[model samples]
Target: MKIDKDRFNNFIHSYTKDELFYRSLYNAEREHPETFSQYVDTLDRNFIEQHQLYVPSLHDSWFPYISENEFFQTYSQNIYIAKHNRYSPEYLHKHEFYEFFYVYSGTCINTIQGKKQTCRAGDLCIIPPETKHSIAVFDDSVIINVMIKSSTFHGTFFELFTNNNALSHFFSHTLYEKTENNYLLFHTQSDTVIRSLIEDIYIEYYGHKKYSDSLLDSYLMTFWVILLRHHENHLESFLNTTHQNLALPDILNYFQANFMDITLSSAAEHFGFSVPHFSKLVKDHTGKTFVQIIRNIRLEKACRALKTTNLSISSICEIIGYLNPEHFNRIFKETFHMTPSEYRKKHTNL
Candidate 1:
């Protein structure tokens, strides 16, 4: 369905918060005089049409239901039941929310950031914000999908991950193998505990009993602590490398702020180091060459622009610091496995 750009813009201007958009439609209906009915109808129809395409819909057999109560204000989390489906579209296809999923009944394959791994009945998957992921059900599945606001964890557990380059690298690239004591996949024993916790969450979610939201939030926090403990234990070994001593968080910040004007020599000079030393330090920390890191950052910006802006591919490339269109196209294709035009077509208005 084509978006009514005028209507969408008007809707945005009318609502202060995303949560109020629906309520605003109702208020607009009751308060506005002439054309009120038309405004409400258009808002309702446009919202449904726009979201229907953006959010993934499992086949009818999946039996998906969601409930969010006013009391549950910490984060937006929900339970999903997917009976059987080959795959669900990428969650980040339209939004950049951090997501977590706990499989309850059957096996599924999760593809995140281009890496694939099997997530079984007791396994849990955590997806960082802006990471692209899709799920393929191997059998009938019941899963709880929790979408946590970035702000909720931005300064807490999320900061822990971002503080260490190795941890961030592992999360960003979808590493599945156990490193040291940390295993992305739970041990059989831990899996059972996590499964029980997930079931408790589901019960609290659907029950909606008095104080249920508080109980559910507590369970989520506990589950996160467990996961973080495992991740931290496993990541300790990688943190011992020389690259860890170079202060990667600062470097990442610098790269992000100056990506539009970044050069290898300039980056090295920023850290008060020789070009070769700084390059090696970055390589050691991220396991990506300096050029690769810069390219990845540029590509990420391009992806965001493609999804959220009306700019043409050439314009996007220029905005993201690529002067040569052909060179940009080649790199974009190599990184995303699709041309800029295709990416824009798939994600625009989503």
Candidate 2:
């Protein structure tokens, strides 16, 4: 398929919150005059212009009961895209497949099993089959729903995610290895690679002629590999996010935010757990002890600073919470197999 990539990107990026809300109001008014105000939570001009307070009927967006060939091309051509517009009916029902929703532009409120999650731009959500979920989206939200078949998700494809604990735990926890963890929300940080892959799929589907289906499968494989590559850097973050423990979120977030000075005793006290109890819990869940976790976080931060900043090695160590420059340098070299200066110089050239 021949696609004007520039024009497509321009059109995708064109809608902001204001434009989306105003356009929705215009459409709603045209479709059902004077009923738009009835759905508004607040009766004000600012609300009318900047936010879409109403939702359209769910009847129009109902799932189709049809064969794969009738739906698209072939049964093997399982992957496809669906759009979630605020004006369209909400697809609350579940099916026998996976739906990965990527918030491509703006933001939306995603409700999975009655729990609400505000997914901003660049966020990706993986919703499994038989899960009761719906998206209470707003104006300006471009939710790209990538549907993956269960049959195609196993064997060699599934092993890619299973190689790591965080993603492995997440996908497995959602796909019936465990319960209580329904879906995963990945903050992709507006990765251009992911955006490009989805756009390629969109273009190929719309302009399908000859070999687009096979090309789409190739794009999907590359897309998963890229996502895994980018996400491996934040394994602990993903673990903390997918953790089913109730107290872990606050403890993990606070620890990450204050990694410079946090200790096991202080963290235990703060979380209202005894030192030994807290230590055991952390180990059981994360497979790493408290000090090891903090040390890794600090070292990761120091590595980023080394590559991105022009700070002295001693200052870099201090910034990452090391009092002794020699100790920091020793560990840095041991962990990364290179000195800070050498690592920085090598990455800078690349």
Q: What are the lDDT figures for the candidates, one per model?
A: 0.53, 0.64
Evaluated against the true structure, the overall lDDT of model 2 is 0.64
On residues 1-350, what C-alpha lDDT tens digit does candidate 2 reach at each position? 25577677665555555546546555676787678666444445556434433333312344533333344334335577755655443445666667788888888887776667688888887776556677755465677788776434432144455353455555544443323326667778668988888887778766755655456667877887887778655322222134554444445556667788888998999889999999988876655688876887788677656655778888888887999989998888887688988877764322
What TM-scores do the predictions have? 0.41, 0.51
Report RMSD for candidate 2: 18.6
The model with the greatest TM-score is: 2
RMSD (Cα, Å) of model 1? 17.3
The backbone clash count of each candidate, in order, is 1, 0
Whole-model lDDT, candidate 1?
Answer: 0.53
The residue pairs in collision within model 2 are none
Candidate 1 Cα errors over 4 Å, as ranges: 1-244
- How many angstroms is residue 342 displaced in model 2 relative to the true structure, after the best TM-score fit? 61
